[model samples]
Target: MVSVSASLAIAATLPARAEDPPPQLTGDWGGWRTELANRGIEFQIGYTEEAAGNASGGQHNYVRAAGQLVLGSTLDLQKLFGVSGATMQITLTNRNGRNLSDDAGLNTLQQVQEVYGRGNIWRLTQFWYEQKAFDGAVALKFGRVTLGEDFAAFSCNFQNLTFCGSTPGNLAGNYWFNWPLSQWGARLKVKSGQVYVQAGAYQVSPRNSDPDRGFYLGWEQTSGALLPVEFGWTPTVGGLPGKYTATLWYDTSHANDVLRNRQGLPLAVYGGDPRREQGRYGVSFQFQQQLTRPDVADPVRGLSAFLNITQTDRRTSQTDNQIAFGLFYTGWLDSRPRDVMAIAIGRTQVNGRYAENQALANFNARGFLQRPEAEYAIEAYYNLNLHSGLDIRPNIQFIRHPGGITNAKDVLVLGVKAIVNL
Candidate 1:
């Protein structure tokens, strides 16, 4: 939902050559758009929709649709109030519709419709202010914000949840809130040359995920805080840009154990309160590079590859870790220079302790149950650039062992995604 905004922020942080303006459906609002931008105020509107159908292997074949609409604006404080190096952003989102993974009985660990969660309601997604100093080498931002907007973030080109957005959020979503979900937070970043380091802290609590709490900003139910640190390197390789990053994160909230009770006995068998762990932690790495380009001066047309790996606290996480890799080729067709073709594969591993707990539950019930080990996902899509500010992507997805259940039937899904910039 925040893909467009997140991309803008990411591009601003990295060094790049000046380029032409991004396309928009509305043509400069008859020159008023450019005038507002020149005056330090720019408005933004984006809409994204996803429709998916389970063609086979799910409990029942069905189709579902979900969409998000974002309304926002950016204020360049340097021009608006004569405060150099200051800027502010405010965004509100409206999300609605159903998730096929659950409604169609797929029960997949990763969603087939990536955009179909976090409640169907209105939300104040972002309200943050940032200041830069040292000739743009240092930046500090605070207020209501989402962690994945600036940490462990990745492109959302794929419709499958496994290969979209932040890996840590995919694994440890209980604490690591992703896009469309904002919490009180602050971040500090310092960049020197091609290397940069950043750290942040964000409020964590179950209240933040409540549908009715979309616009609630009180700190009454905050459990603790999430801390994350990242180091990154952006370099020009073979005259092409590449980014590599590593991050470590810890959540200062008590989480329940996956297998045992407070006295160290099997919770499934003993039937008591599960043990509460002190905290949760994880580490992740991201790599992306442009492999080749027919036209050296055309930065938009190239073959790019990305890899994301993340490991979370096994004691509290159902899925302990994941590894995903993908390749996207832009301008592969001479007739459709703006089109993109991409494919990705990913594996999500269930925590061993959680698997054991499931086994115990099955044994106690005297019923046969397949122990979950891992789930694998594969996807490919051809993005059709129908217009300068609109894109339609039709994709196919395959899932093996839905929900990591070893004996679960594999699933095949057909999907399409539409993106519009207004």
Candidate 2:
């Protein structure tokens, strides 16, 4: 919904300056905005909305709309209080409306309307303090935080859940919390030339994502913790920017096996409770590069590609793995330098063990359950940047084997997304 993670990630890599900020719909506000900037305070507001409807397939056809509004501000303590290399950020988000996948009956593994979920309510998205050292090569952040904001973070520029945000959070979401959710945690990032290493430990409590706990800052009902480490390379290859990263993560919390009983037999057949596991582990990779640039000087006008892969522990995960890739062309036409056209394909694979359990359950129940394999999604969109602070994107999606069922009808969906920098 709101991109507090993306903002924090970018802030970690760059130092705040005592200068005018980016343009917004309300420019300057006379001299007040300039006065605030001089005092190291800057405010930002963003709104995103998605509307989608299924044209074919699914259990029924329906249309739904969802939206999010984010309000945030950053304070540079170095300029405000003479505390060098220190900054603070606070953000609040409000999300509302329904999900197309559920309302439209497109029972796919991922949602076509990515902006929905995490309940329709208000949330304290971010509240963190960061300090940079060694000339911006090292950054340490703590307080209310999310692991996805720093490690395995990806741009949420797409409308499909399969192609948006953090891949690990999508696959292993039982433990990994993404944006609009915060937990007690800390993260450290160290950069050396083109290579960087980052690590974080975050609270693994389910309360963080609870709708009622949006403003609850206490550590009550806490589980264990989540630890993640990442290694990355950001290079200018052939004068084109590229980023490659690998992440390894573990959760100390205990989770139940998806399929097995306490005796290690299929719980579906045995009619017993699933076995409890002590820990869970996962790995993920991200690759993004600007493949072609018509104008060497204009970095924004180019063809960029991205690939994401994530694998979770088989013992506790149903959707254990996912692979997604996409390409977006910016300024393909000289007349529309800010326009973008993009297409993406993604597959979410059901864990084989889970599938076996499902088969056993189906056999026991006389084929009441659907045996799943993998769900695939294809999405394409054209983004019209009508002005500096507004963009409208029209998109289409094709979902194959919804819920990974071979007999299920493929779904076709149409959608539109609007974004405003308020």
Candidate 3:
């Protein structure tokens, strides 16, 4: 059961006003969705589709279509059965289709679309129980949970994965899986005024990512645990609201070095031997601020900017650091108050040691060449509010040094996305 405070906390950063009308698609249920929500049971269903392709300067030119479906529900125990401050949530996700980056050999760190994944399959994403205490000042949640649901939360208004939820996903994907992937975990948070501090302990096991293990909960193969702590501050700027968050994470599992052998020599020079180390860690910062507020005549008109940055342990990760900045403008036109436009740029720095290893490999195998250092991408999009429950977005992206490899040519990608709410 999700508490009222929990719901409000999640919606705090959204640009939508509280007085906005309910979605028309939900109203089509004969007011059943609203009625159910008022009675402590809330249902959610949504579908998103993306078509993307690299039009120029890649290993190849190809287009791909991807789609995802999400179904979820939340229950408030306090309202339904007088259970004090208890809440529960359940969610399932289904993903299918091909990835444009893979098809076109872009080899970029950021995905073109947020819906792309490893496979086309249905999986249980979240089933968590939360309890609040001390006049809603403290809360506890546990079960199959996702890190993104509570920590460093951000909206996915852009098509580029770089601007999506959680900066750690780009810096530490091995240990910090984002939404649509849940693991056994628990989180505790305490709120005081506009500030909150939270910490979580999550299971770290590669088996949890196996699509075939959907809904499976087994601890026998667990390698270790990931501990994350976050501090958040909410403030008002020029009468507009904003949120700033900083998070740190440490994983207790053993991680293999990407480039070095046991003797600290490059793997290419050590006949491909491996070296393993323990204790991986990373840090991330996120800031989202509304620069302008909407007026009575344009309730949905506003502008906001966001920045995300992350740094990971260089010894075990190919990408040592990543930074992204973006701006979002809603109600670009007076007639289309729900429409949005945005642009963003991101850079992923290749780990120096890993680049040296690759350079050594290339020199030994063929000839001499300078090592790759980083990859950069810029993306822009316009979202059209076709209907109350539907949005269509057209996007373009420019990639320089795809995959952080010099051999990969600069590329331009075009894409479109459609989302349906039910």
Please report the candidate that would top TM-score against the real structure.
1
Give the lDDT of residue 404 in candidate 1: 91
**lDDT, candidates in the order shown:** 0.85, 0.82, 0.78
Residues 1-422 of candidate 1 have per-residue lDDT tens digits of 33555332122222121122345777698999999989899887888899999998788989999999988888999989999999898989889989899989998989998887888999998899999999989999999997887888776768999988888989888889898899999999999999999999999987888877689788877888899999999999988778999999989989999999999999988989999999999999999888888876667677888889999988999889999988888888778777888899999999999999998898889876657899999999998888867888999999999989878889999999998878
Cα TM-score of candidate 2: 0.95
Query: Candidate 3 has which clashing residue pairs, if any?
Result: 1-75, 1-87, 1-88, 2-87, 2-88
Clashing residue pairs found in predicted model 2 = none
Instruction: Report lDDT (Cα) of residue 295, candidate 1.
Output: 70
Cα lDDT of candidate 2 equals 0.82
Residue runs of model 2 more than 4 Å from their true location after superposition:
1-23
Q: Write one digit per residue (lDDT tens) for candidate 3, span 1-422.
A: 11111211122234222122224445547877768878888766777798998888667889999988878788989889989989888888888999887877778877877778835888778888999999989999999987776776666666678777667876787778777778999999999999999999999987778867777777867879999999998887777778888999999999889888888778977765678889899899988887776664643468878888899998898888989998888876778777788898999899898888888888888888667788888989888878766778899988888778766778898999887767
